[model samples]
Target: MRKRGKYIIDKRMKFKRGYQRKMILKIKNDNNLTWKNLADEFDVSIQTVMNDWGREFATIPYSLGIRMIDKYLSKEKNLILSYWISEILPKKWGQFLAGELNKKKIKIPQESEGLAELIAVILGDGHLERKTLTMTGNFFEREHHKYIETLVNELFGLSAYNIKLKGSNALQTKFHSTELIDFLIKNGLVLGNKITNKARIPEWIFSKREFMLAALRGLFDTDGGIYNKQKGYKRALIEFQTHSPFIRDNTIKLLQRTGFTPSKSASNNSSIGCTLACNTRIQNQKEIHKFFNVVGSANPKNILRYKYFLKRGEIPLKDKIYKEICRIKIIRPFKRL
Candidate 1:
């Protein structure tokens, strides 16, 4: 029988929880028993064990379900997949993950004891993932963190603190995005592909900025042309680090105060920009897509979006304009902190 939503399990999965929970507590109380021993018995990632360590929660089972459950139980796949995606298999992708590969492509793995969590973050949905496995395993603070430090610096030329911006993605703010992509490719961690026959759009890659963006510092006003076709397809992604996320909000507030009604609607390549200038995004995406879809067509919406972004950069001084709206906020050359 099919399960509801994305979480169906063998009904037998419920066969043991209370007893296992008691045993887990017992094991925690035993001073002589090591986490290594318990983790081995449970057969879960060390990080999972640590996350559940010293914490009382719901039902207990053979393994901490943290690493595999939410993933497999979701829309993506199922545990039956473990049959093929395991260390001991005829075709072992795990062997490649064992690290130190002397081969072509300068390959990166989907999972690694050293890089699993990392690969997850970079190519992942770019959202927060909770894993007791990483927290209690104690590996995150030690190894994972160090790897992040190097990854952030080498790829973005920015630290965890600087990479994030007030907006969720780079094009969402005022940051230079093409520069960031060049940095990531130079470091060889993520991959970008060139999509052709697509209205002169260039390479595209999954995003990582959302996960790393800080809550406070945000990009308020996007100086360049905005996209209406693909909301986030712009090559450069704006991101926010640890600065106050309020910056963008304040700017929005300021814009409202200055009588600029943050108008958003679908425009064509002319308005949204078809060149590399509007590659990534600052949202206003309906316009970006509409622009592309109408690149050569007579579609009115596409024409509007395209035309909106291709305007001259020159800003004419008006008698009614005030100081705050024209004020260039303090923006620094981003360096990995």
Candidate 2:
């Protein structure tokens, strides 16, 4: 017996009269004649058939009932159907009932830069369900949400919906496409129960600079932050946080490839992850600028902070002549600035 909510489904024995009535209706529809032949067809005893016709049996086993239905409907043998049309339908509604079995064909999009970036964002802060992929962020971080929405449209040719939850600053955006999930799984994303079965970035993406940069940007936008302390001793910094060691190490390696040096530190005792931070003025300016030129940011707060740093000359363009002069002076003590 299978328990369905408050009701228990007696799998061993169902009502013989009602089950037989539905079976009779289906057999009649399929133009199958004679209970003995039907019994032979379904591989059931002839007394079971007589019991159904006379309503003598109190119940029927779930397996036998399901086999009869599947055979009559010509359903695939391997499909373990969870539901059956036990109730009789009106003559006019028969068409509606029959049309429900039609399978829909979904076209999976080919992999590309935008799709790769979207997958990175999902790996950072998104969750995958059996039928959908969802990315969530605070209401203030709407740009990342919008960016994801655009990618979904451009990549998969599908429209995604965004929702602002009541009494919360978090905003959720979801695209309902089972085929999209399959595509991600095929492209190296783990599906279903992400925490225990977390996925890693596809190794193939590392070969393409454009795809890598875009994916890094998406991950940074979702899991990274910019810091500007306007206190007694002002400081500017940029940091990316992640619970997954795979993402953390990959991000650090990506930054290194782009000529930025970052330091890694484990989070506080209560937290379970690590952070990569560009802390010093020189490191922050060089790295943040390089990040802007290459990966850039999609979060509005980070974007505004980056623009502010540029406007204030906190991040200056490298002057080759001045640097060359300094190098020359350093080579000879006689030369001065």
Candidate 3:
């Protein structure tokens, strides 16, 4: 569900009891104010101020402390607040503050090839939460995750941190920024449940051929895969799968627009999801080549498979494919179109 209302700092900030008492006394004397006056000034009850001054409470909320520093104390006396904000705040609070403060530093990307590609990547393997943007992959795709980190940094001017899931093979690349999420929503992306929200390609992306191709590249790289139809088949079949009928239908239209005859079929599972396949045949080899030549892949796994097929005229067995990929020395880095 979407979060409502403006953001607020609900967490408390710790201060030494002695320091709290000292600040209350100093502010009261300097301004000739009583406890009630101070309470009114800080927008708190009289008992709240008295308890803080009496050291009855070891901490004050972030909102109260910040008001005291900003409104009551002079610049020279604000060092304590600065230190607490920088070094003593809880890690989650610190991250929240940093994200809010750094909002201005985030770059609003123009509609371009890179932006289209990022949108597709998000639709494939990313999620937009209330306060964060996250892209996840298998642990073995560390190199691909690094590429995504760089892509996000280049496009948004924000750094993405990686988290490896405990007892699992998943790795998450995430950044905190509600502003980025808002921008993405404005560009046709959805927060929370994507399939429930019916997320699909933005209309603007279909306005240009370059944008469509870039979006295709990102979607296929993240969610698509390639394999031989039979054990000894000489041709390869590339497939893109998704649970969203909106995405599946749109992807079929996209493949058709790009000059490929893609076959769509429903999954046998009860999930009602579907897959789109581009099969390489004597008559359709040119179309398969066209897919790679224009809407190429960024994933090393797909790249290795395509390369192996090109060299040997067919894809190898699963065991051999894994060994060959591990042995390959160079994995091409992603480049913006």
Candidate 4:
């Protein structure tokens, strides 16, 4: 005979107490304890819990529902819902949601957040067509959205470039980070953010390691106006090339392109490119104005620029820009610090 405890794990009666125990363990470990807590813990949307019919189960006055759930049971919601689903809902439903969590690129694993990103990736050509996890059956039934396309076009602006950027050549690679992560590793995910003695990268960027490295290289190649300090350097991969002693002798050669050579003049320009011009930024002028003079304006897109320099600081213009043109434009030992 199978042993039983406060919780049961089986095809029948849904091993609810067991589910609650597991979900509760996840809750205690979560640092922020925001909705993200429940989403990550139970791999479901915070909205789902918010919408969970209280009258049907956890009896509470109508007026008290939101408050009771949001304020009082907020911490318990993760556990309660896990209990309700695993114990209350049909056992198959529990497996269904759990299975959804297993799909790659399920973005946040909460109903809306993950769904939004997944749809964005799908319509943007960021995800592959898969029968494993779909928008029709398990997903569509839960989320009553009209169609998946609206959010994709409205948010991601999926274009040839985006598709190309997110695309992969890996035999089984998918465009979106979620699917890519799930597909490649059984339980591994790219941590959205990492904090270390030396540095911090903005946001928890859970995805494939290959993609993470690609993003790093992409940030260097494009401009996202991302500033490390802007996100407190917590949400970004901070790099200050000026601080490196190998400013020219080693790194400049590494950054050089084919048939190109680093010179004092080149170094000056590269230095200028990285300037945030904090000293001269006039009050009230939006920080975005710094890119007004970049030659292409259209090549990398403003967001790319924002991502690269984001939180770092405002860029210098005119005179300062010209001065850096002198330093790394390709000619120097800097002759000075």
Best by TM-score: 3
Q: What's the TM for model 2? A: 0.57
> What ranking of all candidate models by TM-score puts the best one first?
3, 2, 4, 1
Best by lDDT: 3
Clashing pairs in model 2? none
Cα lDDT tens digits, model 4, 165-279, are 1132211111233343343223221221101111112222223332232222222222112233333333322221222122222222322321122233223333223232111
Per-candidate clashes come to 56, 0, 0, 65
lDDT of each model, Cα atoms only? Answer: 0.27, 0.57, 0.68, 0.27
Model 1 vs truth, CA RMSD: 21.4
TM-score of each: 0.21, 0.57, 0.65, 0.24
Q: Across residues 1-337, which tens digit of lDDT does each residue of candidate 1 receive?
A: 2211111121112213243334444555543556566555555333234323323222233233333334323442354234322222222232344523211122232222223223323321121112101111111112223334454344434333222212232210111233443333333233211111111100121122221121001121112222223343332211211111222233233223332333322222443232332222233444333323321211122122233334422222222222322232222211111
Error of 4 at 159 (Å): 13
Of the two candidates 2 and 3, the one with more favorable lDDT, higher being better, is 3
Tens digits of per-residue lDDT, candidate 3, 1-337, equal 1122113345666665477677777788998999789876755444446543434343555666667877778574567765523335653574666646335467888889888888988998987655667788876656667767777778988887787765677787877777888889899888755665777899998888888888888788777776775566677778787777777777777777777888766644333343333222212666666778888777767777777777887866544566554444333433323
**What are the candidates' C-alpha RMSDs?**
21.4, 19.5, 14.3, 17.6
TM-score of 3: 0.65
Off by over 4 Å in 4: 1-87, 90-179, 184-217, 220-337
Tens digit of lDDT per residue, candidate 2, span 61-150? 455556665666556323323333333333334234444222223456665677667778888788764345767787766656776777
| Candidate 3 weakest lDDT stretch, 10 residues | 274-283
